[model samples]
Target: MTRSTPTKPQANPGAKPRVIHPWPLRLTHWLNAVAVVMMIGSGWQIYDASPIFGFTFPPLITIGGWLGAAIAWHLAMMWLLVVNGLIYFLWSATTGHFRKIFPLSPRAFWHDLTAALTFNLKHEPGVYNAVQKLLYFGVLCAGVVIVLSGLAIWKPVQLWFLTDALGGFVIARYVHFFAMAAIAGFLFIHLLLVAMVPKVLPPMITGGRIEP
Candidate 1:
């Protein structure tokens, strides 16, 4: 006689699936962060060499000890930024990430803005709130402008058309600077929000798990 054995049933069938940031998205994100930091630091040094504005970034914050070294570092990080950015764009497009940030409604944005200003906006993992969506979209646009303006500045002679399109080298520098400012501003707010909602930080670093 053979004894029949019963298999154990699966646990918590009703439990929500754990949501995580895809590895590709996370990888590209961190890479972009590193590249941005390097570029900003090195760019500051380069800017110090030829200040467009009266004020210059402090030597402590700038990367590279001298103008030449700063230029080298800036160019090197530019490549990383471009490559990583391209990967992110492709991944996001193919994976439909753009969808999360698009078709933004003025109504929704105003509502969210009011809620945020009043400190009543709820934080939800794995979802982009209206304010977040607007910020992401704006930053993405700024990134494109910065990259193109950078290239125009980098090889103004070879990329003369681009430089001209951006209203020449001097204008390109201003455009690039403003674009950097925008990104930096976004970074400041992003960090501030992260500080306010510390839990969001883990998901960025560790691809946090969340219940639906």
Candidate 2:
């Protein structure tokens, strides 16, 4: 004779409540996103003039003209990114959200690192691991470098002091390019991680609950 099997309890037949992202965080995130995209697109048009690779494409004529439009858009977006980033940073600090993201202890660091690595290997853990904290810190530092270097290059005459501080206009331009590349690299890795763990996207996007 066949025996009856036990059944598990089921969730209520209703849609989960829709949560919203914090206004400031959401605004800053989307603004930064738009700025980054514009910078990269316009930047490519500018870069084509120099042709880093063997291939060369026609110049961009969208915003104004080729390099002129690129420079204008890049500079404008630069200020937007700076203002948004500053607001986010100050808000996090004053609101104590900084502590949640920043690693406070060695034990916590190691634990987070292990958890993150394990999760990447398909052994999911609770929340963001240590590697995430380090990456976040790196992004913040890169943002600072980008802004300072950009100022030196954008206004070498007006910001002569910054140019000198950063070892001259040429050096500042190089630093700015490298910093932008670093930020782009971070974005690529971030997107890859999000694709790998789709559940992770909802919290930042919709302020929805993150499963434990």
Clashing pairs in 1: none
Please give, for residues 1-212, the per-residue lDDT of candidate 1 as tens digits: 99989988776868976756878989998998998989999999999989999999999999998999999999998999899999999999998988888889999999999998899999878888899999999998999999999999999999999999999999999999999999999999999988877888888888888653
Candidate 2 local lDDT, 86-161, one digit each (tens): 8999987886766756665677677766766676434233245556767778888998998898788778999999
Residue 85 CA displacement from its true place in model 2, Å: 1.3
Looking at model 2, report the run of 10 residues with the lowest lDDT sum. Answer: 120-129
Question: Can you tell me which runs of candidate 1 are displaced by over 4 Å?
Answer: 1-16
Per-prediction TM-score: 0.91, 0.75
Tell me the spans in candidate 2 whose CA falls farther than 4 Å from its real position: 1-21, 50-65, 104-127, 210-212
Error of 2 at 183 (Å): 0.2
Give the CA lDDT, 0 to 100, for residue 43 in model 1: 93
Where is model 1 poorest over a 10-residue stretch in terms of lDDT? 11-20
